[model samples]
Each structure stands twice: as structure tokens, then as C-alpha cells.
Target chain A: MIHKSDDPVIRCDGVWKIFGARASEALDAVRSKGLSKEEIRDRYDCVVGVCDASFDVGRGEIFCIMGLSGSGKSTLIRHINRLIEPTAGSIYIEGQDVNALSARELRRTRAEKIGMVFQNMALMPHRTVLENVAFSQEVRGHDVRERTQTALRAIRAVELNGWEDKYPDELSGGMQQRVGLARAIAADPAILLMDEPFSALDPLIRRQLQDKFMSLSAEMKKTTLFITHDLDEAIRIGDRIAIMKDGVLVQIGTPEDIVTNPADDYVADFVAGISKLDLISAGKIMEPIDAYTRRDGPIDFDAWPEAHPNQSLDQLVDLSIATQHPIVVKLDGRPLGVVTKNALLRGIKGDTAPAASAA
Target chain B: MDEDTTFNILDPFSSIDLGIADSAGGIKQWAIANRDLIQPIKAVFNDIVTAIDGALNAVPPLVMLALITLIAWQAAGRRTAILVGLCLFALGLLDPNAWSLAMTTLAIVISAVTACFVIGLPLGILAAKSDGFERLLRPVLDLMQTIPAFVYLVPVVMLVGIGNVSGVIVTIVFALPPLIRLTSLGIRGVNPSVVEAARAFGASPRQILLKVELPLATPTILAGVNQTIMLSLSMVVIASMISVKGLGNEVLRAMGRLDAGKAIVGGLGIVILAVVLDRISQGMGQSGRERGQRHWWQSGPVGLAWRLTRARNETTPPVSAAPRTEVQSN
Candidate 1:
């Protein structure tokens, strides 16, 4: 579900962060001379942490920014809460410019509106699970009993009920991260900034937490800017993914948009290992019904198996195995297109040259 | 001054003097002039030391021993309590004057350490928060540490006058640097990500310091406290040369007379006291750090009471229930 609200929960406009004593000079060079990141680094002895990053996350949208290490994905997310101020441009949260807020107002916004989870979880080592989870609310001077109740509820939501009294060191890595999640949600903030929160876990535990976080976020309807270096994870959990490289956001689109049509060679290579079986929908691969009928004559729609236009390539494959005929892709009981075995194979192979039937 | 006549290039430099002694005299004069302001502060410190000394001496030696042992058992466990009990017993056996002298010395060290903490903690925190403060404080700490305690004794005695209070002032100067340095180190050593996490959650600077940073830095600060206590003990003895009372006086007298046996006894008393305090404080520092540890009540005096009540209630539930019902009816 893509959420498109007029007032985005987070909007980054031409945000730039160059790190070093000469950051402003480097940024100016980038703008005036159109210097590449390396050129700026070499000329000014500065590193561009984020270069002109701009994106809008709608209300309750799970917007994932994916990149390799040193790609500035983490730096970009931190700008939302004003943890790292933009060297240039502006960030707006719910139509209010974040940069324009006073120091007190910024802190209030962080406490009341945004909660973040760290890759290392960063749960206080001295505090018990319950205390760590209750900390955000406690810092806001919430009533102790009320915050405890809210924290316990969040702990339950994360399935860490019995381990509330345990210290962070006593917890396994996965459990500690669950405490991190619990800590973030306990505050009931509108936005959640998750910085590769599950990237450190083993694959099995990572998948489990991803599923848990996805459902919890959905139920709470939290607007999230999730950062990850893993493309598969972005595809699995993101409503829309922004692919970043060398401190620049290269592309922003839905998972299917990215996998089916990568913007450039870097993004294409990045998603090469990611399985597209589920991410590619029937709408992407189907030949239009008119095109199919023009080339192959009218189909006996009654004889073919019917599937929704939203059916994934994997589902279409399943249907193809169950029947000998092409599947008619339908929406609201009207045929939109046809997904023949040849077109399905080409889609699976990521070859989107119009199928012979489209000819 | 002519360098050529001395046949040395540096001869002219040697003729110049820094006049440090004059500077010291100037400070002494200034302090005397400001006696009105300084006197009340000295009197307050004097009263605090005397009060602590009196309170400690009020407790009979055996009772104090038992109390310390009880505390040790709670903080460090049974083994340390037994060891502490024996050490205190040995001090008594070693010197007839041990209890009274030790209490006086203990009172001085306690006051000095309390003063050090009061002064050092904020400075340490400031140093941790600001690099400029750290740079400013670091060199002063070095001078305080490297200056022979004897060298400062002259000025301290002159400025504060000769008394137990002056001795405490001296001990505080000697014992304070470590607490300040270690506290800064502890706070600075707190994981950066954890502090960031706190800030990300909208914690104010004060809240982050108190709730997140200090608690994480406790073990380290306790280690600093342990060092401060040891330093105070040693300085308390040195402070005795200026008419400060305590076991230090005994040691000083024994030394003047060259009485080997008496000197040994006094030294042994101080040694035993040092070992006992060190072990107890170290134990307190290490408490609650073990993996999967239970609540405080599960391990200390409170645990004993809880167990007794539970066992009695289990034996006669009706009797336990009767009291509650009576209270409710009342």
C-alpha cells in the first residue's frame, strides 16, 4: 500500500552534508563547478556525507533508503530528527521546517514525534529491559506508573514479556534488538527512524524481526524512514525504496519499480542478487489484452485460468503449473491483460522486451 | 651579571630567580588579610570533621566491627565479610590505642573524600562535556599530583592554620586529582552510541548525563572513589606532622623516639585498616554486575527477613492471614 498524502510526514529538500573543516567550500564547489564527490574530496579535503538528498515520505509510509556501507544512508536518516543538521537546504516534518525550529522545539519534536532504533540497539547497558524501553517516555517526564504500563504493553507487542527484567547483556543479540524496538514504540511517536536495526542479526533472526517489525509498524501505522544496505530487506519491508550511492540518492520507487526497471548500472547490479519472483507483479509482465488479441486472435477467456493483476510472478508461475492455458489478468472481474507462459518466463528472466504476443 | 667572567654561556641565566618563595609569602599574606572570609569556612569544616569523629568514636569498637562486617556481607558476600572481620580484629590485637586513633583517622579521611567528591564530580562532568574545560583541568591535575605533599603542607598549614581541618584540606588537595581524572574518563568512556540514542529519544542534556551516562559510568567512578580513599588514608598520616590527631600521630611519635615495636604496631594498624576498606569498597563496586543477578533484596539483610517471613508463613498460613484480617478490620 503506497500512502500518498498531500502533507508528507518527512520531506528532505536538496539536503547536503559535507564533512570536514572545508564543508561549505566543498558544497559550493559541488554546486558551482559540478564537482564529483571524489573531486570535491580531493580539492577541498572533505567527504560528502549526503549530496543534495531529497525525498518525501507520506503519512505512515515505510520508506527505505538502501545503500552499501559509506553510501550515506545512515547519515540521511539522521537528518530527519535534526540529529545531524543539513549543511544546506531544508527538512520539513508535517509541513513544518525542521531546521527553523528552536532548540527547545526541536527537542520536543524529537521526543513527541520521532523515535529511532539503532543498528547496535544502543539499549542502556545498566538498565533492565523494562527501564530501557521506558526511558524515552521517562525522559519526557511522563508519569512513572503510566510510562511503565505503556512500556510493558510495547514489550508485549515485541513478544518480550517475560524478559522485561533482564539486562541488555543478558539478552541475545536478537532479543536486545527487540528491546530496541520496544523502546522506540513505547513512546508512541508518529515517526520511527530505524537505522539498519536488523542488519547485525543472523539471516534467520533478521527475517523474523523484519516480519515482526513490518506487522507492528502496520498495526501502529508509523511513518518510518528505514535505512538498510541490504536490497532484499528493502524489497521485503519497504513500501518504497530509495537506492543511494556515494552520498546521492540514485532512485526512489516502489520495490517492483526498482527491481523491474533499475535506474542505472549501480542499482541494477545492487538488485541483481535479489530474487524478483515475488517482487515482479502480473501488471508488470502482462501483455495488454488488445495486443494479445491482435496478434493471436481472440482468446477464449472462459478456458483460461483467471488471476488478479496484482498477482506476483511467483503466483502466476504457480497458476501456469496448474493449467495448460495462459492466465487472464483481471481487475474487478474485467480482463486487463494476459500473462502467457512465454511472457511469464521472460518476466522471470527480467527481459521486458515486449513479448511476441505484443507484436 | 657577566657571562664572560663566569666562562659559561648559561651563567647569566643562573643568576635570575623566579621568586616562588615570595609568591608563597604573598599568598600567605593575602590569606591572612582575608581571614574573615576564610575563618568561617575553616570552622565549618572543623565542625564536620569533629562531628564525624565523635559519631564514629561513640560506637564501641566491637559494635563497629560487627556493623562493618554486616555491610561487607551485604555488599561483597560472605567471604569478604569474614575476611574484613578478621582484619579489624587483628588491628585491635596489634595496638591498644588502635580503635580510638583509627576512628579519628577514619573521620579525617572520610571528610576529605567527601570534600573531594563534592569538588571533583562537577569538574569531572564539565571536563567531559567540554574539551576546553578538559584542557584547562588536565594540567592543574598534573601539578596537584606531582607536587610533593610535603611542599604543599607548608602553605596549606599557613593558610588554614594548624588543626584537623587543615589536615583535611591538605588530604583533599592530595586525594582529589584521581577522582576528577577518573570521573572524566568514565563519563567520556561511556559509549557514544548510547548517548546518541538518548538524544535521539529527546532526552535533555541533563537527563542524558544523569540517567544514561552516570549510571553506565558508576563502576569506573567507584574505582576512582576507591583510589581517593586510599590516597586519603596515606595523606592522613602525613597530615599528622602538623598536629593533626589520629593513628598518624602515633606513627610520628614512634618514629621520633625510634621505637621500632611501637612504630610497627602503628604501621600494622594503618595497613589493616587500608586492606579492609579497599576490599569493602571494591566489593560494593562489583555488586550488581554479575550476569543474571537477582534483585538487591535477594542477596542482603532484606533477603534474610524475607526468607524468615516466608518460612514462618508457609508453616502456618492461618496465623499469617489472621494478622492481615485484624489490620483490615481495624
Candidate 2:
């Protein structure tokens, strides 16, 4: 199951968070004596918020955890940033165990390495938009001038150029979310954790913000863990989607994989109504396009211009559409094969093409 | 105590009492001459009494019952108003003069309490805004409220000495607490959010208090005013002990002579006054709540006077306005 990839920027291992009075004892009983679920419930009166959940978030990936309310998606995301302490687990961010850090160190880690955008926007009502955007930097003891300059730039980056002087209440819901995003990024943290940030907004505004967020992420290339209940949103933004049910990680895969090959009935039920053909892309199913192939008039150099063989079928389709030519897919800059529009369409439709195989 | 301290405070003012000594001396001569006038005055009083009696007698028991029914209908609803009306009829029968005495006592107490409210509210607001000033006056208000009405008499008798002024002063002392307490409470209880909203936009504390807090707390504060009026009414009988003429003195006279009828009449009068005043003030408070308008005029004479002065000042054109117009024209 190990994919050929770089080491994950973030990793969580056997995370178990039980909430109740005798949580520690229940955890011990389960670990040492292998207590049954009923026995644990009877003895400790506990709720297993996160039970043995593990995942790795790759660098520059918009990894989304999709779940219904109370599905521990938020809790799992919070554990990575250490906003909430896990009962029994280890979360490593950039090779450092977050749980082993002291309170000051945890705060410093949050300040320096992680940025969180809350669902509620959680902007301090007392402050103006500019001040809220600068709060994290201010908290890190940056001088007023430095933080203010950083905040102004971040605000501009979020397309909130004119709203710096306005209070949180003065702005509409969508604008406030932008402010929240700007505030999260103002300190330039390495990773961003968003917990249902756009759920509170209107549909049109949510879509607009989602598009903006994708473009921003593409530019910034920060590793992101976005928790959302909306399935479509997860598909739209997440590079990898993790589906959770009742505190257990049900399935973790690309959106195409989740749609085509769900791990269990639960995952199947989730992706049941979705049109798999539209969701799957050529890059997800195509072999690398051959770069050195002899082709008719103007080989559209950008179409299959040197890329790894593992570039997803979706990326290949996107490149095919962008370059508007038959793609010469490359593996390590060597021609693997050629994938034309028909082959891409076939790949998108879940067809196996022998001619479009990687070299 | 020195001899001078022992001497009554009123002694020096005895010279200003022009009519009393002469009237006492001439009482016998005047009575002999005005014997004819006495009969006519007595006749008028008898006629009035007969008229009242006739009016009561004319109403059938059924009519009285209906009247009671109507009262109950009006007060809280049909039932309570009817019950109250029946109670009133029973009280009227028990003591005829009680109604008039009660009305007069109520008027006096209400007037005094209204006077205290007029003075106390502004003082409370002023104190609330200034911590040092509020601290300074807090002890004084505590003593005023806690010290018995009779204890106030010791100083009041020393100063003004046993009359309506002294009675009014004592009533003010007992009734002033609620006005101060409520004004402070109302001022303090203003929604912090609303206040912050106002301040965030650059409103001063005074403006915030007047525009936001005071308006919001009016109903509760008016309730305090209602309690103050009720307390003042309760003190009427006690105030009468100091020679202040009212139903209380009549009750005192009845007690001195052991006359059950007279005592009952006076006590019933006080009760009637209490009920009537209670209804009116309670009605006013309800009306205030319904209107929900914090207009200065609705507050009372002080607010009315403030508005009048404000209006007068506003009538005059400002020098700046004239200059601005000239500049614009130029």
C-alpha cells in the first residue's frame, strides 16, 4: 500500500481520544487486557472520539477529512495542531512529536508551524479586520510595525484591500471568512488547518471562496488539512480525501479512488450518487505520455512537457485540455507513450488502454 | 445638656405666629356671634352625608354586586376587579369616612414621594458616574434608609419642629431609597454590548447612558418609583404622630378616646387611599412599559422643565450658523 512518494510533512499514529471520567483506566484496560467495547462502555462510561485513527498528510496536499457532524473529523484535525490534547496517540509535524511539547512549545509550534481557521471565524469582535489579521503575529511578540505591515499584505493577498478598517460585524459572512483566512496566513505558518470554514456561508459565496482557496493554495503550496462535511467540496479541494464514520477512519484515497473503489459499504454509500466518470480524470488512469514520439505538425510541447509517470490521470487530462493536443506523457523526461483525446476520454470513463501504458 | 440646648427650637419662631393667640382669645366671642353660621354649616354637612347615604341606599345589593363585578373585570381581569369591588363595598359599609380620609392621605403621600423621585434620580445618576462621589454619598443614603422615621424626627423637630414639612421630610427619608437604588441599578444594568457599540463609534459615557442604558432600564426603574410611592403611603400614619394633620391623627384621636368606630373609619380611609394610589401608579407603570418611549416629557416635571429650557435655547439661531450661511453665500 506504500505509494512512491516523499515523506509526509505530517503524521498521526494510533490516535485514541476517549472522553469521560475513567478514560485513562478504560484506555489501559483496552490496551493491556483487551477489554471489549461493551465492557469499556460499562466500566468507564466513555466516548471514543478518535479511536486508533492514523493518517499521513503529504507536503502541499489539501488533505480533507469528510464526515458528518460529531464524526471526529474536527477532533482529528485538531490533534495534528494540538489544539486539543489526544488521550493516547502521537502526531508528528515536520519530524517533531507535537504531544511531547510543553504548553509554551505547543503554542510556539502553533504560532510558527501551524495556522488554524475555525468554522465560526472566531475573529475577536473588539478588533477591526486589520487587527484580527495581525493577532497571531502580535501574539508571537512581533513589533507593531512589523505585524501591521504583514497584516496589510496578508489582507491584500486575501482580496480584502478596502476592509482593513471595518470591524468583523460590519463585514458580510463571506468577507469575515476571508478575514479568518488572512489571519491564519498572516504569520506565514507552514501548515493550515481549516475546520468547515465555508459551511456557514451562502452557496454562491462558498463556491467563490472555494475557488479562491484552491488558487491561493496552488500559489502558496502550504500543506493543508481541511475538515468539511460537504462531499462535493471535499472532491473539489482535497488532493486526498479521508472518510471517517463514528470516530473511525473508514477510507483514505484520492477522490477518484474513493468514487471508483470505495473501501467498504460505508464509503460506497457515501460515493453512491456521485458520477464517477466526471470525477475521475485522465491523469488518474493514464500511463505517462511519450515525449519523444513522432507526431503531426507542432507537437504541442507544453501538453506532455516532461512530467513524472505518476502524475495523476486528472492532471494529464487537465494538461491535455490546456494544451489542446495529443499528450506525450513522459516518465523522467523519457517518452513513455502518447495519449490522445480519445485515450484520455476513455481513461476518464474508467477504460483500460494498453497503448497509454507507462514506459 | 445645657439650658439653651434644652430650649425648644420653635421658641424663636413663636413671634411669627400672628393669628393663633388672638384667635384662641376671641373663640368665645366669635362662637356667640357665629352661632347662626354654625347651624347652616352643620346643615350643609348633614345634607352631604345624607346625599352619600341616599346614594348608597339607592343602589340595590344586586347593583353593588354588579359594580364589584365590573371592578374585578377591569383591575387584573373580570374576576379580580369584581372581587376588589365587593371588598371596597364591604369596606365602605364598615366605615363611611374611610374613603375620604384614605383619598386625602394618599394624595399627600404621593405628592411627597413624587418630590423625592424628582430630586433623587439625578443625584443617583451623578453618583453612579463618579466613583469617589458615589462612595462619599453611599454611607449617607444607607443611614437615611436604615434609620427609623422617628429618628429623623429628632433632627427634624430640632430644625422645623413637628408639622407637614417635618412629615414630608421623614416620608422623603423612608421613600428615597428605591429611587436611588433603582436609578443606580438601571444605570449599571445597561447592556454592555450596546454600550460598547456606542463607545466603539466614539459616543461619550453620558451619551451612552442617556441614549442606551437609561431608556432600556426605564420600566424597571419606574417599578422602583412605584415601590417608593407605596412606601411613602405606608409612612403617612407614622408621619401623623408628629402633629401632621391627616387620617393618622384621626386614628390617633380615636385611639386616645378608645373609640372603635372612629379608629376603624380612619384605618379604612388609609386603606382606600392605599388601594387607589396603588392602582393609579401601577397603571402608569404598565402604560410606560406599553409605550416604551423614553421621551423626556413622560418622566415628570423635571424632565419637562429640562425639555422646555432645551427648546427655548434651541429657538435662538447660532452665531456659527449665521457665519456658515454667509460663507456659503459668498
TM-score of each: 0.93, 0.47
Q: For model 1, how does the per-residue alpha-carbon lDDT over B1-330 read when each residue is reduced to its tens digit?
A: 344454446575565566877887898788777767777888987999999999999999999999989888777777888999999998888767888899898898889989999999999899989999999999999998888998888777777788998898888888899999989999999999999999998898999999989988888888889999999998866899988998888899999999988888888878888998899888777844461235555565666887687767776655421321111111
Instruction: Report the error of model 1 at residue A165, Å.
Output: 1.7
lDDT of 2 by residue, B1-330 (tens): 134444457775533445765675465555556656555644553354344444544566457546544433432343345445655666556555554444445445755776788888887787767778778878988898888786556555554445665677788888887888778777777656445423322234464576566766666677778788878877877888887566888888999999998887777767765665466455445532133322323333344565577568777864431321111111
TM-score of predicted chain A against the true chain A, for each candidate:
0.94, 0.78
Candidate 1's C-alpha runs over 4 A off are A1-5, A293-306, A322-337, A355-359, B1-7, B10-12, B23-25, B31-37, B309-330
Residue A354, model 2, lDDT? 44
DockQ score of each predicted structure, in the order shown = 0.73, 0.02
Give the C-alpha interface root-mean-square deviation per candidate.
0.8, 12.8
Q: What is the C-alpha lDDT of each candidate?
A: 0.87, 0.71
User: What are the clashing pairs of model 1?
Assistant: none
Highest lDDT scorer: 1
